[model samples]
Target: MKDAAFGALLAIQFLTRLPVPLACPWTPATRRWAARAYPLVGLLVGTLVAIAGSLLQGLLPPPLLALALLSLWVALTGGLHLDGLMDLADALGSNTPLERRWAIMKDAQVGSFAVLALVFHLAWKGALLWALLAAGASPWWLVPVIVLGRLGAVGLLVAVPAARGEGLAHAWQQSLTRRDLVLAAVIPLALSAWVPGGAWLALGLAAFIIVYGLAVRRAFGGINGDIVGAAIEGGELWLLLIAWSWWSFAMA
Candidate 1:
């Protein structure tokens, strides 16, 4: 249990670039468990982001607060998913075949399509978050959304096969076990229970994971680190969009 907890915290540190007071000794087994614990990192990220946004509530307008929250989120994660989003966008936009698309993703240069996609994705998220805040969605809602989004992404890691021969996804691809999946499922469910309207949030998470699973099967042939990142960003955006829409309609 200590190893598992440390592994989880290590994963959080890796994903969020957050400093920890203590460091876990790295081992192959611990590294494997770290991959399994990656999703839980979002719980920590969400808590910090919520605290920041809530604190800024009185000082900043809704749009500015949303931007600040979004910026903090990207900074916390070191823009990992944003890079994936860009790479995926560039690959999909190319006229080349699947083999070439994979090659394109390997290139370090960001293409026009990638730039456009990043802009749209970030803009959409910022606008949605602002709209949610303006609609008077409670800060409590953000917590579950963030936590569930990451868990939903983790579900993808377990459910799909890696699309590439190498990368972080490939490195720990074999780490996932039946017990790991069970633990992942349980953690999010338990955490969701703490939030207001959490049942709906959990339902949305289930739906997102289900849909992403199907999409991964059809689109990417399987999952890679890129797809996992895409799932996390996409899930968060989808949840925020739904929440904003609901709030807007309710206000109407």
Candidate 2:
């Protein structure tokens, strides 16, 4: 139980900007333990966003509330996933050799493709979220969606080879295991069971795994932390889009 609690704390520490007052001896085993708790990190973020949205929904227009939530969302994770998305965009858009593309991803400067990707991503997410709010959809779905998004990272980290021999992915890959993957998936699966139209969540996650596997293999040769981050962003968007589409059809 103590290890589980620390593992959860370590996950929160690594995955978000949230203050976790506990510290544990950082080791490969520690990282492995924390990796299993990745979905819980998403759960915490989603819960916070849901509570905030519910509290403020009546005080502001849907668009404004969405904007506020979006801002909070980015702040919570310090744009970590978005940064990965941008890095992947820049690498893929460069159309260079694998070596050069890897260099491009490592470059700290933002590229044109990254800018466009971020703009489109934020615009789409904001618009869809606004629509959901306007439709009076329960905020409960966000928790599972967010959890599933991070669970996407867990899948890729386990299923794909690392792109580089060093860095966060390499470190994490050392600790990643089939058991960790199953542990990471459990919460999202349970949460999805309780929501209406939750099959979309499973569909979206399955689609992301297939699509991301093919695309990343072609584009980067393998997965890394950035690809994991990109996968999370894409996965979340996939879930939101699926849910939005389902809501549209039901209303029609």
The Cα local distance difference test for each model comes to 0.78, 0.85
RMSD of 2: 1.4
Q: Give Cα distance to truth, residue 19, candidate 1, Å.
A: 2.6
What's model 2's lDDT at 29? 71
lDDT, residue 236, candidate 1: 88
13-88 per-residue lDDT for model 2 (tens digits): 8779998777676777777778888998999999999999889978999899989988888899889899999999
Which one is best on lDDT? 2
TM-score of each: 0.89, 0.95
Clashing residue pairs for model 1 = none
| Whole-structure CA lDDT of model 1 | 0.78
